[model samples]
Target: MRAIFFDETDAQAVVARLRADGFEAALERERLAGEDDDEDHPWAVVSDAPAFMLEVLVDTHDGWLDEGDDDAGEHTTPLAPLDLPTAPRTVKRPDLG
Candidate 1:
């Protein structure tokens, strides 16, 4: 699943942690604050692992998974493309048969 993390620290820490945890992760800076080049920049990541993730946000630090404590189970799937704001776009049918 695609996850967006907003924090004041460089995403390298989290990226490294995720990699160590055997996840396919990457860190990319956001261009919103014109401080992307700095070590402390806002970043996002897309990971295939469904395990819990730790992040230090501007307000607090914590680790959490999409699934709750119930532990029914969690699965990762591709993110759907967002539709345009001005139109109701059609979802292409896939050849699943």
Candidate 2:
């Protein structure tokens, strides 16, 4: 699957994390037309991992994935956090008198 990232660093970070997690990932430079050298262009992250896993990574790291097709045609959305089956967190507040 392919997903758009903000910049090369973010793309590389995703690739590194995926590789560390035992998934193959790579980045492809996507330059827009009429963009100058100084302008920031986005990169696309390509991975061979499962969609769910990619989604999780994207969600946790603030990335976005391509959601192909709907009544309104193709669109992209930020990955939503998965509902993991885990224990809830406990927060302790400081005693303020």
Candidate 3:
């Protein structure tokens, strides 16, 4: 999960809290396309914290959650089985043995 914050302090705070609570968390720079200002890039809190926990933090920090890929939460079908020969083939026409 990812949460974006305009304030670096807020992003750091959230990461600290998540770590204290025993969840994997880290901070990074989030660059949005068309944003020419290099210093204006937002800070992102990347974490394995629960959605509810991150949602509350995002609300308090004036940021939003970037829930990546709409289809990411959906289930995917398993791979199809492969076809095989009815019997094992003989090795070297059974003459090398």
Candidate 4:
């Protein structure tokens, strides 16, 4: 199980808690391309814990899971494209009486 955390303190807390619970966990830096700010890089926690266990911790710590790098196995369906108008939106529509 893997979790990405924006706060270093949260990441460390998770790691400590997991270790205390007899689970193997490791914390590392998660860097993405085009991310110029070094301090903005999120922290990654890789552990041998179960998904549910990790999910609970992640939810409580304001973090999210990194379910591999593949989006092919995702079950979610993509939403239809929005047809946005090019012109400025009016404050009041004539049809809304």
Runs with alpha carbons beyond 4 Å of true place in candidate 4: 70-97
Q: How close is candidate 3 to the true structure, as a TM-score?
A: 0.71
- Model 4, 1-97: lDDT tens per residue? 6899999999999999999989999999999789999999999998989889899999999999988855534557878899999999879877986
Compose the digit string of candidate 2's lDDT tens values, residues 44-75: 78787889988887786677886645223334
Q: Give one digit per residue, the lDDT tens place, for model 1 in 1-97.
A: 4344556243465666668889887766545555655655446655655544443321133322233332233445547898668867778768853
Per-model TM-score, in order, reads 0.38, 0.56, 0.71, 0.69
Instruction: Give the alpha-carbon lDDT of every model.
Output: 0.52, 0.76, 0.91, 0.92
Cα error, residue 7 of model 4, in Å, equals: 0.2
Q: lDDT of candidate 2 vs native?
A: 0.76
In candidate 2, residue 23 scores what lDDT? 80
Query: Which pairs clash inside model 2?
Result: none
Runs in model 2 with CA error above 4 Å?
A: 33-38, 67-97
Question: Which segments of candidate 1 are over 4 A away from where they belong?
Answer: 6-10, 31-41, 54-97
- Scored by lDDT, model 4 comes in at 0.92
Error of 3 at 85 (Å): 28
Better model by TM-score, 1 or 3?
A: 3
TM-score of 2: 0.56
Ranking by TM-score: 3, 4, 2, 1
